[model samples]
Target chain A: MTAVADAGLDLRQIEQFLYREARYADEHDYDAWEALWTDDALYWVPAGDDAADPRSQVSVIYDNRNRIATRLKQLRTGKRYSQSPPSNLRRVISNVEILGTEGSDTVVGANFVLVESRTRGMEIWAGRVTYKLRVVDGEIRLAYKKVSLVNKDQPLPTLAFLI
Target chain B: MDCVTATVPQAGTDRPDYSALIQPERVHGSLYTDPRIFAEELERIWYRTWVYVGHESEVPQPGDYVRKNIGPQDLVMTRDREGQVHLLVNRCAHRANLVCEDERGNSNSFRCPYHGWTFRNNGELLGYPYHQGYGGRGKLNLGMATVPRVESYRGFVFGSFAEDGPTLTEHLGAAAGEIDRLCRLSPEGEVELNAGWLKHRTRANWKLLAENETDGYHPQFVHGSIFSVTGSPIGALYSEKSTAVTRDLGNGHSENDLRPEFRRHGEPMRWFGTTPDRVPDYVAKMRQAYGDEAEQILVEGAPHVMIFPNLFIAEIQVFVIQPLSVDECVQHSTAVQLKGAPELNRRMISQSIGSVGPAGMLLADDTEMYERNQVGAEQLRPEWLEIRRGMHRERVDERGLRVGTATDETGMRGFWSHYKTLMEDDK
Candidate 1:
């Protein structure tokens, strides 16, 4: 719970932002969740962990701003039967660390365990997430985010909803 | 010598009558849920037939190899010292422990983790830690067992356990033409599958996924949401009035050939709905190589065809279905990489990322339907799943191929009949 004096951001404020962002995703609030991203937003969930180059290898979900909007648009359609009946979702975020910064962006890392309940069954997903946050207009905006699942190397079930 | 022909069952042996279970217009539901039938299919079809291994491009240089499975068998496809590729059982000759553990790598010999026994990439017994223990080795000559027949067509490799059964070409039969059509897309007449596989697992029979791969009848209904949102012209290709037709390529191989519909538009790169201006270099190279046929190749695009028990060239991706058990199956797929056309490959990669895997806009919806379908198939009331759609309109073409409308059950009939032929052969 140490405050980050270098980036001029405290631990409480950053943790609050992360929790709110997660809550938006958990509630399927596509508009609010999507608005958190900057115009240069990069949302990635790399396949088989976050080591390989995305240009040569493949990914589960790799959206660079425009693709992110298209993904949200598809979810908003309601016709996305995979999420027609959204899964009941909840998550616990922990182990937040400030891993330094790049330019105005603050590089932060955290771990989470999400639970999704649906007609198929209850699914528990554990992953490590890295986020690059930048303050624009005195508000925190997500510049880059990547989720690395423990089982990213293995066969996965349908992940139609936002991670 | 005819692999397609059915062999008679010898007298006094207990053999299930597959004909009664697989009818002309419908199939019994028990075939999906029966554990006994699943076991039989492993022995009769998967293990004995020509199962797809991996593409040669995957193991381009000597010592490069990839791990794969043909049914329940554990295998390693290795490129040996002589630049020859061999499909070897991953077990060590001495202890039966796996020799190759990596999903893919470059190795000239694999040493067993359990014992010190080593094997050459070509399945030869190299040596062990102590040779004198079991009588000093003159030459054990008893290397790891190899798959009986390994063959390749246009760099696509396939392996067979049965040495006496159908040759790979004989098994491919009419399906080979579609493969040629796919390869001809490359200016060098080649396709590389270097992109790693994305696997999607479901609690359903493998046959169900195989049936749905080329099942044009269900896309409009199963994937309507995607069509509604994307408004892709490929959606129209699946409609009833579209010129595209389904073909029964025999030996259970079939296609929802959308060439005629794309050709009707007379547009270049219409498959991806992109113009020549966007991909001037790809179009230019393709034009220079094939001349007049380039237009047809551009429009025809990737094939939506399923090759018998395990393989599929599902438009932008290549799929291999692996049946885990009666109620479990996993599908492995990779985006098609058109060699020498970096521009086209890049687009296919991003387009495919959104289109098929577990999180795909298209496949995710279909997967939900498949899971729901599996739950329904478990119900006891309905003993049969009907395949009688468009039966009256289906007719045999001049080439003795059964042709039907885009949304017919003709492809399914082709699959099950050959399934019956294989299951009934008893030998």
Candidate 2:
């Protein structure tokens, strides 16, 4: 594990990157959001209250880079009925912290509360996010992003937009 | 209690008769609305018929249990110390308070939180705080009342509140063959619900789910987005006139057979032998397990089977509808995986989640349509909802089952026919 001092990555820059990533998702900026991921990026939203291995248990979203691209393409086509009109989303990212380093990747943790408004109603989605970020050409790229929703175990309404 | 024996509708009122509401070719919208009809259904249909409770694998050991509901009645499916599974009413025998509240757990006994009343997992009254309170009581029997009949077929447990109706086998009828086919797909001829379940609350009548399970007519239209996005060949396969068949599997059960070739698209293995790299080991394992029957058992698609009121075995997924009210229901969707095939089970779980999870590509569309149907049903102008899509074209098979084309409403007619008989039995 590399210490924060040894990694020499600016905390403010990392937070700014996180905020920008979230803003792009909230605005449904698919291209910009897709550009932020590494070629082998993993996007996971585990089912139930606790996270489990995606291979062993069911997950709300467990997409590899290719699957993520396919999902984005579906959304781009405007044919996904769940998000036909797209969700009006705004998120508050807080409690950002650097959780040391794994290999060449910098692990980051943060808390988020996303509000999604659609035709049915507005839903308050709160969850914790963990990101494995790697530096590509001096720019932060996401290697893995996992979202653990607070009400994952409960019956959830349609989550059409990206979390 | 007299509500059960009340006339279908008051003589002078404008309410439509129950008989006219459910006819051979059509059904009235009030069947999906009308609190009176809903209550009658809870008693006559849900209570009398075989309702799927839980799978045997859910309680793999003694003391394991899961709470389930039949219509509005709460019950617990528990395995007793003697290894016998029991479906007991969750209410405490002492004061009618619920005995078990947790969704699932392994517990030797359930002790009521309100009072100190304790009962064995099998629903037998173990002890109370003060047993001598009523001078040994007046015919005191505090055991949790078990549903009249509890039975299982091929590890699928079902319970009926009515004591003298059909046995589970008689109730399942032709549906039992579907269950057998599902179990036979497993290399070891067994399946488990261990891959966790996803529950979604739908703002639609419970029957909408039953109708949607095998209704091959709406997939192309309702799930148009999915078909366009995933490029699934299901739309084409279903549209290939004579290739697919919809049959009214006797005793209210119905099925839509989209042919074995339909499994080529989106399933683990395609018919053209282009297997994904991730599941090669799993495919090899299946081949080793089933030998020559691997292609048929592993690759041949399973028909969409709806077992009467509640259970739906949709290929790799098993969906159970728990009706909360006339307008509300909870769908418990579980992925069925082979007992001995771990990697293949993982692939199955992934596919199930991708298509049926709360945020799934397919189910999300279906949910929206179901809610829309409920909203549309509120308009009383259209009194009857038609189920006569292929009424004239329906052909009787050698076994006396009604068979129709893929996009036919023969399955819906079969369901309504059986439902009408049960609701009107009155005896």
Candidate 3:
């Protein structure tokens, strides 16, 4: 996209950050995962259609900074049965593009396919992720992230793991 | 293609004796596992009973419609040009394909993709292409079939496939009071379900979700993780000390009533711990609409009631359980938006997302129990589920509804007795 050229950000740096972020999430490294977010982080997974506003329409998961902390805290307790005996997870992140830039943040988009295996069965999850990356103290942080699942509107199983 | 079919040997040629299977103190475990029993319930309970379809608020305007399911039968709930709500069986009149494919949309009519058979939103046949091939449309013995009766009580729509049976109001009986409580909390005396549903698929019998909806006993144990984190005051309501009671609101409906505990506090919004300043407009509007009774309305808040086979008013959300197979079901939840309270509605929506749904902090644990129960149901050694928690102490209230303590199995026993009646009756 022309926005990538206009943004003048290092594409290789962005890709490395995304790969590291994916690793932290797949491995359930809560500390590393939470550290990657900026203080004003907004993590969202919209339900039904992608365009439904969070302020109006319900979401599968919509967490501000405090909610993000609470979610990780719940998982840390080791009793969130949905993830008690956590499922084995591996996610492939690809199709990375620096969509554009706003203020000090760079907007990037990517496609992901995640395979989650548990005692019940295996589930194949695919979606598109939009991320707003910001640089603070020379370290890249996730300011905002929204996941638009292909099957967002359908009745789905437990998604306690980080998407 | 050649298909090989096999017949399995079973005991009784007739239906299983529901009276023996669903005893007063215990129920046979196979009711949760037997495919035959599930098939029977699909007819007697799902199709015959007045099952919740969708809210009238969901289709307020003409051309608005939403797709729903009762048992496995697909339906389209639509508002016609005359503003009458109709429940149309989604099959095409000509080829049996779904007439409306989208989950929801605005369309005056539905056109079938297979054979170009069109249907008005109200289930009337519009016309078909190449009509000369089949004698004119007047003689074709097919049209989109609508449920015989569709009725609404305060905007909650329910449909029964059987033409003549108990009126929706009769089926609701005293249970409608619970729905009224939820709506009366709204300043405008109405509730809107505009928030799109976040459906959570559960690998368990649909009855499990239904029973668990009002089982106040399980929350302290099933959702202990949430209590440990939030130190929720609401958790105290289910304890032995609290005065909250569970009711067998006749006709299979039941409730985990928290009013006694909340009213004891004599404060408003104690259900969710909000201050008056947070929802001043709502409080004021409610006071204006309800007069002096607003104090009790604010104190009691919304209800935690589940209506018979399908609908559950889960406090602030409209929850529906759609059964797919005997061991699989989906719980659809949409946050209820009050008609005139924007401030309270926003907070309720966020709270609904955090508490329920598939990934919710609280419900995920409950879902785990539901799935585990399914796995346990297959065991052969223990054939009965003991659900007579409060039978010894339960009492009939002034309204004739049986009542038990908060942490009793009164809700489940009530549910099963009602189920047995419907399953065993020929009518």
Model 3: colliding residue pairs: none
| Candidate 2 reference-contact recovery | 0.51
Winner on TM-score between 1 and 3 is 3
On lDDT, the stronger of 1 and 2 is 1
Clashing residue pairs in candidate 2 (N, C-alpha, C atoms within 3 angstroms): none
lDDT tens string, model 2, B1-427?
1122222344355543667667777777778887778888888899889999889998999999988889778899999888899999989887899888787899989899999788888787877776688565334666999998999998999999988888888888888988887886666778888777787778889988899888988888877777787787667656745367889997789998755445434354552223636666656766788788776655554547999889999888899898888988888887887777676677778777777866777887788777778878767654668899988888998888899888899999999989888876868
Docking class of 3: medium
Model 3, residue B107: distance off in Å is 1.7
Q: Between prediction 1 and prediction 2, which has the larger TM-score? A: 1
| Chain B TM-score (each prediction, in order) | 0.95, 0.91, 0.96
lDDT for position A67 in model 1: 82
Sort candidate 2 into its docking category.
medium
> Residue A121, candidate 1: how far off, in angstroms?
2.1
Worst 10 residues of 2 chain B by lDDT: B1-10
Better of 2 and 3 by TM-score: 3
Give the range of the ten consecutive residues with the poorest summed lDDT in model 1 chain B: B1-10
Candidate number achieving the greatest DockQ relative to the actual structure: 3
Clashing residue pairs in candidate 1 (N, C-alpha, C atoms within 3 angstroms): none
